[model samples]
Target: DAGVTQSPTHLIKTRGQQVTLRCSPKSGHDTVSWYQQALGQGPQFIFQYYEEEERQRGNFPDRFSGHQFPNYSSELNVNALLLGDSALYLCASSLANPIYGYTFGSGTRLTVV
Candidate 1:
């Protein structure tokens, strides 16, 4: 009964570099969603994946992409990173139905120098 887990709890990258964040959904969860949370701000949806396909996306640019594997694990890739992209990347997992809220990971803090 583990919760969502994200790797590289913290990362430091430079502008123009690319970074990939990883996440493993909780047991029995089939949907995975990614969010970006800036300091003192709420989490902003990036995209959601289900059945190994992207089902919904947020206002982020194409540089932000994600993939869900058959095991319900997921990855978030950001290309040409910008300083503004520095934030806490959160991964959440839940069932397709909204009967229950999402279970979030500890989050990956990215800093672009």
Candidate 2:
């Protein structure tokens, strides 16, 4: 079974530009969650999507949004990016409610220039 995968393993953006990162979940999974990890910090939950709808959202700003497709893949979109947005964007997949350990893809290192 194919595991989760993310595009543009690394990305660079300016302070005000918008960026979109993509993710494909593991085979047979239906839930996808996004996390942000700052240098020296643990990954912070941004949001989670299931059944093509957002199921849970973290304390991130309105500028952070996401979408999950019927295929169980997902994309994270960030607008009016700030320098603080520079971090590792991680995507994790689970079978259902995420009570189980997640399968995490290699994160996309985003740098706000």
Best by lDDT: 1
The deviation in Å at residue 102 for candidate 1 is 0.6
lDDT of 1 at 49: 95
Worst 10 residues of 1 by lDDT: 93-102
Best by TM-score: 1
Candidate 1 residue-wise lDDT, 4-107, digit = tens: 89999999999999999999999999999999999999999999999999999999999998888889999999999999999999999999884889999999
Question: Please, what is the TM-score per model?
Answer: 0.98, 0.96
lDDT of 2 by residue, 27-109 (tens): 88899999999999999999999999999899999999999987889999999999999999999999886676899999999
Candidate 1 local lDDT, residue 93: 94
Poorest 10 consecutive residues of model 2 by lDDT? 92-101
Root-mean-square deviation per candidate: 0.6, 0.9
Assess candidate 1 and give its TM-score to the true structure. 0.98
> Candidate 2, after superposition: displacement of residue 17 in Å?
0.2
**CA displacement after TM-score superposition, residue 96 of candidate 1 (Å):** 1.1
Deviation in Å, model 1, residue 111 alpha carbon: 0.3
